[model samples]
Target: MIREKSKERLVISEFFKPFLRILQIFSCYSPVPASSTAYKMYSVVEVTLLIFVPCFLKTVDVLQSFTELDEALATLLIYVTFFIYTLKSISLITQKDDVRKLVRCLDLDIFQPRNTRQRNFIKGQILTSKGILTLFTAGGCFTCTLLDLQPLLINRQERNGPINFWYPVVNTTKSPAYEIAYAYESIVSITHAFTHCVLDAINIICMAFIIGQLHSIEDTLINLRSYAEKEVNIKGEPNTTEKIHVQMNILLIECVSKHRALRRFANDLNKIYTNNFFLILANCMLALAFLMYKMSKAATLDFTFIFMIFYFGTMMTLVFMCNWYGNEIIYKSGNLHTAAYSMDWPGTPISFQKNLLFTIIHLQVPIKLYALNFFLLCLESYISVVKTSWSYFVMLTTVSNN
Candidate 1:
């Protein structure tokens, strides 16, 4: 029965499992449900459409002189951003086995909630973050769909398709063909939104789990100190002192091992996602700038303007969440050294103190998430991104005026 319970905790909770399914559908990768040949086939087809369709349509638009320079640039930004996502998805699929191992490491029973308080806290955090992401994604999809269909609904007299998709039909502006194109574009837009949401959620959840690990480590250190205090306070025989010392040393060793494992887990995650994060950072800046320019130049409150606003907001929120949680990891990790220092060390022998000192020094560096080993993911980097986006926006505006 104990073994069964341990296995159960090792599995992801039912509440969070659907997110994994969505990720698999969109990215062709999942930590659970391990990838198979069928999955690979499906992923290749889905990713090819997701990446190629937009680029093909935009290329046609540019060749046909169907869009202004600003509009074309904005469309190109979407194509490039989704291309980056495709590359990341390919990386994730290729490294699916390693990702599975990382997920399993995180799912170990030792990391599971030990009491009601902890269980509630973990569930609350997971639910809140998941709920927020789900709601935002739904809203974005709705907005995108509305934007796509608004023209059809608002203008019954004029027959025009929603998106500028390249159809094989020579005259797509006709009734049935136009409607078909509109429906196709709407579906594609929603699927694109769903893809973005799932990918971003995967990164967010990983950071949340790491933060939970940091909390667990801090709690273990506290419990170790309490155990040592109790051992010292108890009025025992003289020989008990050496035994208590030995017990404390054993506990410290276990703590150190756990800490080392956590560090390794973090490093592995960084290695897997670093390039993806860098791509997100680069895409966010360009998308924000292009979108802002298009929105500013718009003369009327059309679907495109409203959609751009939501799109811009979504990008900003994603960037902020990534940096916020990443900074939290760094902050929580730095506290591990403090936790070590606060332990009941004075009563212990010098050899034990040396071990603790080594642990402290090792932890002082703090765990950080970096993008391609060049840009660190933190609130400061987020601020810089916003500043850079603004600078680009200004430059674009100045050139447009001239």
Candidate 2:
């Protein structure tokens, strides 16, 4: 058991090395115990001061900007984004144990590929996850850079910080205060981007892994008969038929067990992230709406236009990925019943046939992830989000014109 556990840890660590490194840097994942002072201090500094405080001030600014429609919308975008950052940070800190449980729940024994073919599939999925994460991080940094440089693009007299924060005591409109505020906002803003990327990476990568496992199960079921035949042929026993039936039963049982484990993992994931998903969907809708309206008013070559473009594109990708993986899970799991039916069970023993029937019935319903039990995280929800954003944008434009 110890050896098996050690191997599991090793495999998981190697698989997630890149993501884990970035997560640690942001204090989202720590090697040390969560109860340790060092870990607590690091998390506090990274999350409380950097995320919560800024988000609070940004919320204040969002309320204050209400008097001016354009200003309010602009500040509201940042506020929405920062709100997500704050929620993500707080969740990470407060639900430390739950997060750990989620991580460990990806039991290597269940997820690890048994064959070279499955191994190659898993490898490709890992590479794809890493590539997506890298792109997300790079894009986030690039967006932050564009935002931090926004004030520089304008005249010095009109200069302001990237964030429209309502500082408690400091008069940030003056020369030195303005510069200080700009620097602080830039740092926090960049950190927010990184935190966003890291959390999304964790969720999306997990979903990717689940999708890969589902594919492996499907493949196994589809090829179950051939696999059993090969095993029987290799043995060359007197009771070849009985051996084949036994082998089929064994493989079928393993697949059923793995599938159930995958379902449990998916449920745990939904519990951990459903609230966050609700917030993300809500925020993205408002942000994308206002961003579109604002971009329409700005000159094509202006800094504001360019900045909104980057921000808009980033949000689109984030929303798309969340829904895409979710939809993939549903689609893949939905195919499991078909795969089981495809298994050449016609000639098998009545016992084997009965087991296959049970498995098929169990897999009838496709697996799904949801937001507050209202929004199913799939392409359909993606379309709904986009449409809602468009409606909000239209409303804003009408209100502004009046």
Candidate 3:
């Protein structure tokens, strides 16, 4: 158990080690799904076989019946959804440790109130970097959903011609029945896409934070290690005080060393969040789009299929979000531990960090990598926008051709 008391006479080990240990718990999980590594391989194999067997049967059973077709399709959706979901889970485990190690590397102390300016700087960096990124991704997902669903609704209105049938539900006619019947379903699809997108965005936001945290950790560790090595060489003669100093220096070094490995695990967690979240959203939308175009094309009077997709989507999203939050609590707690461990250096004023950025850019951040990743992420997002634009253009062309 790690304590978060300011008055607590700053035990650096108590603070840093415990929290770090707790965080590693999330990073180390095998992608294979079971608690045991021995059966882990078997678990993956079993899942693969199970999914494959059904898919194989489906291939053979394609001509069986609509029931078979429906079941097979749903199974495929489930398989893809869970498979990607697992990868995301694994990635997050890896990302969070990367962050923790980087932080341990920087060795920021949450328990010590020293370095007020530096503390604020790092805090600002975290909020703006991760928080803002999260918000941006969330907004983008929402906008995409609205735009995608608009086409569906517009098409519904076009094919149906008029809203007259809905006006006379009790005395309905097939003439305008198709459009009116699907209204409910279309509304559902719109809501479902909207819901799923938000969740997906949130997942990405988590990853972005994990990335930022990693940057912070790495900066701290490198500087502290260099400072420790310099101390031993400076102290010349072998005496009791020098020996004690050496031992403490070694302890600090070990903390950074041990932390490096554990933090890598933390970073893995963030990666999982980014990849899994997007995959979930994309897969769900694809499945919904297919159903809307196929099964709901005729007999359906309103948008029932869209609604079902949205309804299930909202429920699933909440479940995944809760899972992420559960894991993060361990990470934040671990960080608190690392901060306590670094408090042993009483002479080192915490304020040394505000100058840290000016003192050393590498320790402050890998600006080159930051710029590269940020640009790459933005480019990927832009590509999606372009793809959507082209898709819209093609649809317009085909409609004109028809």
Candidate 4:
């Protein structure tokens, strides 16, 4: 048993290593590596670029004569989203202890997959979702970077850098200064993309873990009848009715406790991510609206139009994944009551039957992920967001045309 437990832990750790490495780079308090002097130095530099570059650009937009208000607002939205994620990462770091405690609570033998089929199913689900999201993120970053550098590559005499910012130097177009600024912007952009990808990946991973737990619980409940029978038998001798009753009562008590613990785990997980999910949903909707407006205004074959389409698609896909997985948790949890009902409870003691009845009633409500307790994260909410964004975009386009 000990060896199997150790192996299970090792396998889980191996599965999480890639995400943990990414988290360590972007988060100060991740368990993979705690804060060090070098990490702090790197954090300082990254944070500065993330926060200052956007502010500088906004300021330049305000000062420049030909700057478009909508474009400036779009840029501001992007930076604000980044800023919110940065703060979210810092908040997660401070709650590392709580996160560790939650994980420990979930580290139960019952949660492990029971067979090769179950194990492979969980592995495949996680890998396939992560792979798709990673590919989309990487592709978006590549396309955006290429577009940003298109001016410099196509027109050698182009004076403007890839991104517009208010530099202290007067001759930002000249050599040395231009090269330095270009390098700085490129580094900042790439780092920002990396941070975005890591944070998004972490969200998906958390959802996957929750879904896995739900699956484990379902499996345990499905086999509870045989487990109870085994508990009542002693040394190949059939137990008395009273003895079986007592043993079954004990088994039901343990199952109830496990159920409560799983609920608490889900609640803690929800609390940690509630605000972050809310912000992501809210920001994605606004960005989608803005992107639609930009796309509608751009020429048919313009680079801006093409880029907006890709950006919009990425945002929609991400929001959909989050909602889809969140809804799955609710869907699977709702089935637990049915599983409990299906258990072979005939001829059981009245007390055992009562306990099973209570379990059924409790699970009817189903566990859910909520955003700030205001909106439940589900497919319905995802659909509403899409509709709202489109309505907003249409309104903006109508006003612009007039």
Candidate 5:
């Protein structure tokens, strides 16, 4: 009976279970109901020991060898990447209430489907989100495994472990010490990979949901007249024409309210993530520039070369997907105005016309996600960042050759 009751109450969040499980293992976050006091403390300890401590040690190691620009640069890349991941994890924990609200909003009545068609539409989005998450998580884990396994495949005398992080009071070069360090780094590397994949997946899935909602709204708006007529017919209300107009007004009000809710959701999303996105963009561009420089200098297709190839691909995908979904949001929201205009509004009551006219006017501006208010996240920005990274790579190669 308990199991049956639980199954009956399951909501759309079942689609996100994989992502949440990954996050739980990484100690980044879990849903509010599951975030008990012990889990919170474990999250703190795991993040500090596995992420923050290594980051600090790496920073110290880099500073001690600051004059060796090339060596320091190589280590700096790892440090910067880990720093960004740690910051994102900490930020999510600190803003748990806002994130909880956002997640809870997903299960709200307004977001639920009203008919079979709507249910199918949302299910499609859920499937797409899951597919993307699976591919991304697999790719990420593969890349991290390749990087970590390089040490095992190489000669013992030449191995430097998975990462170049410094450990205090621990000689990472000796036998037992090296084995312990290797295991620790492997765990940390996998955690880092999963954290990036799952956190980014959360944001991507949220945008997917918003896109689904927008399409649902468009369909509702386009079919407003038919829906109104159906309701009027079923109710068998007197003054059928008057009842249709009344139904249209009620439906339009609901659409408008949902539109407003979506805007708020987007706003909250930006407020929490704008700065992080900006930092991530900057980090990707910088890392891509350095990776290109190194790849260009490689004389053979060695492990370093292959590793960089995978790393480079991961960064490119991250940037591209962020912009791709942001662009989708903009495009879908902009079409709302057109959807509103096509609702067969000619014979509707004056009040319905007025409400729809206001809706069309408001939606005209469209929606956009910005990175630190500097630039919009879209294909154009992605192209610009790639071009800029290429220029930097060119300059570095020229300088090195001279």
Candidate 6:
């Protein structure tokens, strides 16, 4: 038991590593379940689960769904998960914890963080604030504006019904609840995406800072070596070599620090897209809502939007997910317990071919998932154009058949 406690203490020294271990234990194998309270990182792991549980249980019409520990419990879990993460945030601000200081100690002080960290920090702020805004937006303006979602909501029971493969349109006359829910989910997703992106940016920034610092230290060492070479005539070759060897341990320390950063960066990115792919999930939900609405009419405009959403969403999801592989490998190489930059895609081993798809995901994984909110604006462009364009000019909304 003493040895076990010491082992636990050693592992818990890292900030987020403990939380990751908990996750591994929770999902992998363990008897009687582990304490959910045993977390250190402010990850959305809990939030993601919460978002799913309550909704899933509510749909199944089971009261015990709230109590059960299964994947089917969606909404309840979603609530619980978010609640936990929020609790962590609150704790971080309120506690006497020293994790941040510990991280500072562990961090390489040689390099400087990239702009990515600031950007990510900003994004996190936006998510925290804008997600709240999104929540309100999903609730609608509430100006006593009554909307009929029936025109847009799709009936899921239809068999062999024409489904749109392009852009999706939803009627706001009937399926208001689902639409509202979907919109709210979008807010949750975007917020989460922003959070993850911000975290990545922070990691990058920290890494850049560390690496920069290390570079300077390396330069100093090189200068010292040069000086030592010049002094070899006086100190003798053996004495000069001895002095160089004396600084060897410091060099080794710097090298280790550099290598670990690279490896951690890669591993973190490889898993990034999947961990925070909620934005795509939100988009997919929006597409579903649009599909729900399009089913009531034979119009192609609605179907086009559906197709566009699916096509774009799927492609984007695939791109984001697959990009992680290259990122992981590159970072791994950079942090390879040695000082070397990674330069290959699907690199080093042929076996990584299977992981090539993931590498692509890593490569394209943007630090800010919502940096292209303009595209989101474009998505909504269909709502206005399709509804009003026919009376104005050459109706492009009527051009394609979904």
Among the numbered candidates, top TM-score falls to 2
Per-residue CA lDDT of model 1 for 1-402, tens digit only, reads 011122235344455467667767776566555568887777777767765675577567656653566656755656655566666667776777776677667666556653344455555656667877887688667766766776767665666554566665567778677777777777777777777667667667777777766776676566665564454555353546676677677767766776677788789888888887888788888888888888888656777677777778878877888898899999999899898888767878899888888888887888899988889999999999999999998998987788
**TM-score per candidate, in order?**
0.85, 0.93, 0.34, 0.84, 0.91, 0.30
Runs with alpha carbons beyond 4 Å of true place in candidate 2: 1-10, 232-239
How do the residues 156-265 of candidate 2 rate in per-residue lDDT, one tens digit apiece?
57767887689888888887988889999999888788778877777788788888889889978998977777666656655477788898998898899989999999
Give the per-residue lDDT of model 6 (tens digit) for 1-402: 001111111111133343324333323111222325544232235444433332343344334344532322222323332333333333322321232433443443322222233224323432343343333333332210111222234454331112111112543224564455445444444443333222223223333333333333333333433333444444444654455443333333444454345445434432332322333333333433333333223355564344433333332332233223223333433333122222122122333333433333332322212112322212333333233322321222233222
Candidate 5 lDDT tens digits, 126-221 = 688778777877788888898798877766577587876777788888889888888888888987887877888877787788888888788888
Every candidate's lDDT:
0.72, 0.81, 0.38, 0.68, 0.78, 0.32
**What's model 5's TM-score?**
0.91
Task: Report residue 305 deviation for candidate 1 (angstroms).
Answer: 3.4
Best by lDDT: 2
Looking at candidate 1, the ten consecutive residues that score lowest on lDDT are 1-10
RMSD of each: 4.1, 3.1, 13.9, 3.7, 4.0, 16.6
Segments in model 6 whose C-alpha atoms lie over 4 Å from true places:
1-54, 57-249, 257-402
Better-scoring candidate (lDDT), 3 or 4: 4
Give the distance in Å from residue 21's predicted Cα in candidate 2 to where it truly belongs.
Answer: 3.3
Model 4, runs deviating above 4 Å: 1-13, 32-34, 51-70, 73-77, 93-110, 114-124, 153-158, 227-252
Q: Residue-wise lDDT of candidate 3 within 1-402, one digit each (tens)?
A: 011123433222232332334223323233233357645566455434333333343344333333643444433433344344445444544465444434343344432322333234334444553454344334434533543454357565454321111232333335455554445334333333333333243333333344444433433443453434444445543544445445445534443443444345344433444455355435444444333333433344444444434433442343333333333434443453344334444444344333332233322212111111232223343344335534644553454357
